[model samples]
Target: MANMQWTLLLLIWMGQCCVIDCQLYEFHYINKEKTWTEAQQYCREKHTDLVTVTNMKDIKRLINISPGNWRGAWIGLYGQTDGTRKWHWSLPGVEFNESEKNWNTGEPNDKTGWQNCGIIWKNLKWGDLSCHDHQYFLCYDDKYILINKNKTWEDALIYCRDHHHDLVTITNMDQQRAVQQEAQFASTDYVWMGLSYACTLDLWFWVSDEVVRYKNWALDGPMDDCDMSGAMETKGNHQWCKKDDTEKFNFICST
Candidate 1:
């Protein structure tokens, strides 16, 4: 009887340890330069795949602890031929949570029409950039880390600026899927993001810090009409905004 009791206690302790271990969030790094396919293979071989975000809180916690890394990195979201951007995880039929989406400019735009990979930027905003762009990324599992308070897509963008520097920009596909999952629930329609246009330069700019690198505008979309407060007549000044908050053809907000 004594031996059996001791064995049962030991089993209970071991089970507790396993639960705790699974809850602990750890960071992984991949330094090899390769195509998106190669990178995904590398991550999978290392007991992980490209990073996947779950919520804004997870993003804040992950970036806060990471140091000495590049600005943009690969994630898991990719483009489809149906003219729709879907989260990779959602490809498995998992519902997206609005709280997980932290788009800097509020919408997913595959400018090149061929971009199938995602990336996270310096300001923690998410975007669908070319998979050829090389950078370090983040990975997440069964860990719970509280992120910034929930706010509307517009409010969220402003919050990122007022507090954390800029709206969340994706550097890789992993981060993209994570954000998509979080914001998916609240996303009834497209929303506004941190991306915008520069009338003088006639190019797209990440509203977070005005950094312009990836220019993937649709055919004659952002036509800068000199309307500072109104919509753009063409693709020149067609800034990205939330789809819900568009008051009379304005921007939309998710969650």
Candidate 2:
């Protein structure tokens, strides 16, 4: 009886260690010289896409890798002068949903035959603009911080509690939008969200103890994983994806 009890305890302990979740991304810098197209191909074959700089955080990261001299490098940004108007978000996961767009009247005319990027006007309407045009851009600052280190969900939660507040809690669309904006700076396709399922209760809840009343689950909905936790896609629609807690990933913590 004593031996059986000890074995059961050991199993439980192991299980606990296996269910850690995380959210965040990693980056690598290549010093090789190449044009934008070449660099894109190289990054795809060797690493991920050529560093997609979406926010100041990404810019700072790039600056840190500077050669300390007046040397230039190629990034993933380019202009399509072929009169092809393909709308894409400067940020990754927040894809341009045609069904959810608000374009200005007769806008996106590609008036100068060089509008490839997009912007939201003062009226909260979107417009296709010149990719080369230098203009003021909107930046969102959520109270959450992205941790670049890889850790399990449990480990990430503890780190957030010890360092910042706790893992982030998204209660509404506004909060979700804030998180999605923040995620654009992530190095990973998905970042951890403070959501989890309790097998004992057979219910989902946020780590911040907020009721799971609001959700932005992925099109497929949350996957079944009693030992899994929630993460947000950093590339498309910023929907939540269920992943095993044991999977190591970069994470976000609330401030």
Top TM-score prediction, candidate number: 2
Per-residue lDDT for 1-255 in model 2, tens only?
A: 111100000011111223112112334444443444454555566544543434434345434543333133333433344455454443345554556545679876778776655554444344665555443332222356788878889999999999988888877664676677777677777888789989888888998776887788888887666898999888878889899999887788876
- The alpha-carbon RMSD values of the candidates against the true structure, listed in the order shown, are 19.0, 16.5
Q: After superposition, how far is residue 81 of candidate 2 from its true place, in Å?
A: 17
Please write out the lDDT profile of model 1 over residues 195-250, one tens digit for every residue.
Answer: 55456776555553534433333454455533222121112233333123332221
TM-score versus the correct structure, for each prediction: 0.42, 0.47
RMSD of 2: 16.5
Note the clash tally of each candidate: 70, 14
Candidate 1's C-alpha runs over 4 A off are 1-22, 90-95, 140-255
Clashes of 1: 70
